[model samples]
Target chain A: MDEETAKMIADKGAWLCLQPFLDDEDAIPFPEGTPQRTKQLAMVAGTENAYRLAKKHNIKTAFGTDVLFDAELAAKQGKQLAKLQRWYTPFEVLKMATFNNAQLLKFCGPRDPYPGELGVIKEGALADMILVDGNPLQNLDLIIDPTKNFVLIMKDGKIYKNTIQFK
Target chain B: MLFLYGLLGRAQETAEKNTILIINATVFDGQNEKMQEGMSILVEGNKIAKIAKTINIPQTAQVVNAQGKVLMPGLIDAHAHPMFAGISQQAGLTSQDGYLNLVAAKTAEKFLMQGFTSLREASGNSISLKCAIDQGLYLGPRIYPTGPMISQTSGHADYRPSTSIPYDPNATLSYIERSGHALIADGVPEIIKGVRSVLRMGATQVKLGAGGGVASIYDPLDVTQYTFEELKAAVDVAETWNTYVMVHAYTPKAIQTSLGPG
Candidate 1:
């Protein structure tokens, strides 16, 4: 079935999810003008290799934060990815971690049936919200360190945690 | 002071150690290596410390000559239904439910006698049977167990007559009482819930019916019961629980559709 699908698409002169193999040792190509591709890399935060490949292939990539639970390793990868021009913004990264993933899995629309003005937090939306202390928009690191910015969290009309600190 | 003196004195008085010597035996080490030529094996305490070509007899040593026997590492049967009663269940012979533990214990012993020192039981008599065997409450092979086979409704495990409702309460419990298994739910949500329940109950691997079965009245032999989305849901549940999902499949369509591109 995979081969059949691949052949059908290839016969039409279109390829989904193109993975590039390069002969050059150091150079990774920048794919032009939103190159049509998607990449799913597992153990994403565990290795910088996937990021290097993602940049080379010009594919949009998403990662779960499970890799690099080791604090030192996470910092190392964070530093390495910062040098790349195609590196994802922290908010874009968070979107990939949350909403982009939900989109890929088709989880947030009519089939999901909980649309609140297009998932970007409009008023009169079903407020299934996560409130973190610091700003996740500033850095993905804020997610792992709740004490730095997260003051409270409410979900479905319940206060699971309210860690407001008055200075 | 008296107790300490007595203990020291007792330790100083040496008792003779008994020796056991077995000669002329073929031995197979657990690591798949074999030895021949009737070497004598010596055991002191629980360990086999000495193996020699020849040993002069000590008067105190117990000697036995095994001239014609083969000794292999205890075999471990990876999958066995120890409580399955060996019944071709269609015959309807009183349903193996009577004295299930006793039967399972005996079955475990039979497995041991067949040189299986370890057994991975998929689904069986009950948790009690496995617990008994594992806790040394009974003499049987060491068993790593799954509590019951979790089945999706009207799938391969919808083991009920067409006349009854799919969730016939009496029939469901009766099946468990008889076969030690259960048919859980029908759709994706129910299937995921059932998988979670089984995993929480200590099933290391969740068994799913990806295809129809010989006994299933819901679909025919070639028909696929689970959709790709449902299979993904099941896989997600299994993944979150840190276990594997083993789907029961008999047809290519079932395997292909359920496991395609996942």
Candidate 2:
């Protein structure tokens, strides 16, 4: 993004739904000079600059991973979030994924399908939460291995996973 | 894996008590930067009833000791394609008999297990899959579906080969179209219809292929799609239904052109 675009985003109060997609283990390599490979490189080359400009202009940013046609890439969702630590603090990264992303969802207004508070651990909010084995803010990389780190996952107050053993 | 599945299954059975008290948790409430240590939370039904340093645990509540672990709101993905995320390109176009959706279901399950509670669909036919997840028949994130991305012929979303050319209106829809993957729409009337069609399918918003896309082979990355009238028609239709349109664009001209309409 250029300064002008970043300024426009800030001026319009628009949310920059940004993703930290990189050429990592998640991506399947395309042969050189193919349309897919050229496009992928062009798409990725702008990401870092976009983030810096968005932050410099204080644009409202949301985190996402636009994974498609790749199951292996889909599994790296947490790693993508962790990748944000390069540009933001661990707390800021979590906040972007949780709070900021939900703000964009809430922007849907009456069209919101699951109408209720989301992406917050507060009284009267929808009971969507994750119980991590370790403090995520201190050790954000733990999220990359969710099977062992995310001990419990809850949505709508339902326990979808509870790996914790109680005596 | 079997033993863990057994535990998870048992947890589900007991989790229906509608009230749960999580004690001794390190709280990182989404809005706050500071983390609270040794906090507790009480959930009643599908909402958080209380969160404080201490809570009087009801005898009926299912108490879980957090063991001072961190608790935070589940993650949300602003742009995702749950219906297409886990499948290969070949499988996306060739796999028959609902095989793609089964893989999508697995992807959704993994999404939740990895702590993503909600997903906003960027483009895909996700309504039925979302319904199944909502009905508790499958495990996945809460989804807001867009049905399909509207596109013009030779635009970003076109999936037709040269073999199926000459633009025969009476011809049968392509497999991708019939399966609700993409809508090849052009002109004002078709744009309006496409927007309304997705809304009728319960799309939270309409998505438009307003420019060329990387995955779209036919159009170049610099090409801007949808004339002013057509883009305006889509926006007008979406507004009539009290919704909006989201476009996929990558270039200055493409972005500026769509911005002109919306």
For model 1, the superposed segments whose C-alpha errors exceed 4 Å read A1-167, B1-24, B29-66, B88-98, B166-180, B215-219, B257-262
lDDT of 1 by residue, A6-98 (tens): 333334332121111122221122232312111111112213443454444444343321111122222222222222224566545444433
Top TM-score prediction, candidate number: 2
lDDT of 2 by residue, B6-103 (tens): 99988886666688999999999988989888988999999999999899988778888998689999999988988778887767767762887888
Expressed as tens digits, the lDDT of each residue in B1-262 for candidate 1 is 9999998876654234434455665543322222355666554432344667787765656565555443222323334456653333342224546555565676665444332334445454345766675555765554545556556656665655556564556653555524545545667787788777766665655566676543334655556777787788877887776555555553436645555524
Worst 10 residues of 2 chain B by lDDT: B252-261
For all the models shown, what interface RMSD does each have? 29.1, 1.3
Recovered fraction of real interface contacts per model: 0.00, 0.76
